[model samples]
Target: MNILPSYRYQMADHKKSILIFYVVIVGLSLIFGFSTTLIINGNDAAVHGSTSGNEMATVIFLFVVGLCTFKETFLISLQNGVSRKTLFTAKLLTMLSVAVIMAMIDKIFFLLYAAALSITNSQVTASTFYEALYPSSTAGAGPLMLHAESFFFEVLLALAAMAAGYFITIMFYRLSKTGKVIVGAGVPVLFLMAIPWADQYFLNGKITIALVKLILTAVNTPSHMAVTCLLAIVVFNALAFTLMRKAVVKQ
Candidate 1:
């Protein structure tokens, strides 16, 4: 039998044309980061460098990549004779794959740069490479490792964001006059549900901490954050697949 049309649609998307642009942007960031360090510390570049900025950039990069994938999903769904479910599944898988790959490349760059610095400074500690990629919690920032077990939670969160965006778009398309009000109302509704906050009566106090710990254990164990990230890839793709399978295609 011929391959599914949904998969074909993903392959046909033209946004891959932007891949070169993303690569150039990332390359420039890397060079700029390295150059900034060299400028600040003179020949002793290790003394003034940081991966935190790059890490944040990677996150932003992933978000943009997510948007591109969303565009593909939307276009695929609009195709004639294509099953909505199949279109969704294919695009979800594509997005998850792209996210995982980008995350890995980002982490690799972070670790390599960190390791180089640590070696140059002769300040190596018991901290593993994962810690290098995701620094310990400190003021003003949270842990950043999207590893193996916690992968499910993070990726699911991302997929939820994507779905939520698409749903709002659909709602707006269907209800032009009330679209703004509906989207404004729907955004906060979805945000409160997906984001794990402790002030709520249901998620407050020790229960919240317990849930957070459980999530940490799943996504990151102390050694390989990649595993958690991979798991997330699977989970998010699965969720997107399910959502698409059940979505009602209009027009």
Candidate 2:
């Protein structure tokens, strides 16, 4: 797989995509980090609390990195010569792995920033810092990693969302020229709408909210809210993938 044309194809496209992704990632990080530093340092707000800017950035970074990496994973799978089912499985696995790594990196970066700047309360030690950073879910498990429980549901949701996107792109690839325009514009608009709807309907309301909160927090944490978002993305991806698999490719 390492030297496969599929892998090479994926990597080649990612060169440009990764550059663009990095630019956005760095820009967002700087903007959020600076704003957080200013707010924490300037305000009389409790630094160690959940409302910290650093905390917000940590969550944002996880999501941004997860989605970004997932896109690359999907593109990479296209380069690997495989059946649609195989591609889907490989891409989903890669995306999940990326999400976990991104979460860890975001966590570490947030902690280091807090420690270096002394933005946290003096009472919060490094060991306690992690616990506070990743508070226990209502389920009683502290968090995914470093804990006995696995975030399997969360992982599944992330893969589902990514699969949905890959399928959507393939669907677009099969469209007539006019249909392509409709899809290009329509899909993103619907996606934008879905973001808030997922929050209002799934994340905060109904059995979905309780189910998630039971397993994770729906508050400010990424780990808390990501599974919900990923599920929404998954619903779209499943439909898209099904359609794409049936789609007629001209090439």
Candidate 3:
């Protein structure tokens, strides 16, 4: 069987869901943008509006979509007798394609927002999500380079999220009912209880400081952050595939 064609067909099945997601996002953006414009127009002094929330929304949407896609695709493909290897390849391709498309859409939306602000003669300033993510260095780069870097980072982040979602799904699928219960309930409870205990007892209330230092280190080293993210993506997907290879389809 030609796996490429089969994969394309399987991805096509998700067009409706993708379209709905896009529509919802666009609709909300319009509502918020217009409302903010109106509010600013009514004010006496010049006000600036920011669309920084768009990046967070995009990340969350991609993550949720990734989780749904992996779970649904795995079940359908398993029922249809698809090999684990083919399924993994298909999922990887689908996630990359989706990441590219979403990144382009985000850029387009930013342009549209900027144009609207200009046309309305609003004092509001708009920036691309990439600018928000890499505020300092992005401002120094040429437009093409800035966009290229943004696209690359978006693809890496999306792939990482997809891999994580797939790995989680596989873990659940491979667990027994009791194990699932333990994972679903016990894990969260442990995190809730253990975090404070560890911070107070083990770290002497310095966990927050350590976390801030780690974040600052990462922010200072973009290349290292990118490499770390890529490594995480590979590890997550590798674990997911390993689990899938040994997983039995649920009856």
User: Which has the greatest lDDT?
Assistant: 3
Residue 150 displacement in candidate 2 (angstroms): 12
lDDT of candidate 2 over 38-115, digit per residue (tens):
666676766642323233333343344433443344444555445556555544455555445444444565456557
Against the true structure, whose TM-score is highest? 3
Clashes of each: 11, 3, 0
Candidates sorted on lDDT, descending: 3, 1, 2
Better of 1 and 3 by TM-score: 3
How would the candidate models be sorted by TM-score, starting from the highest? 3, 1, 2
Scored by Cα lDDT, where does model 3 land? Answer: 0.76
Kindly report which residue stretches of model 3 are placed more than 4 angstroms away from their true locations once superposed.
Answer: 206-209, 219-221
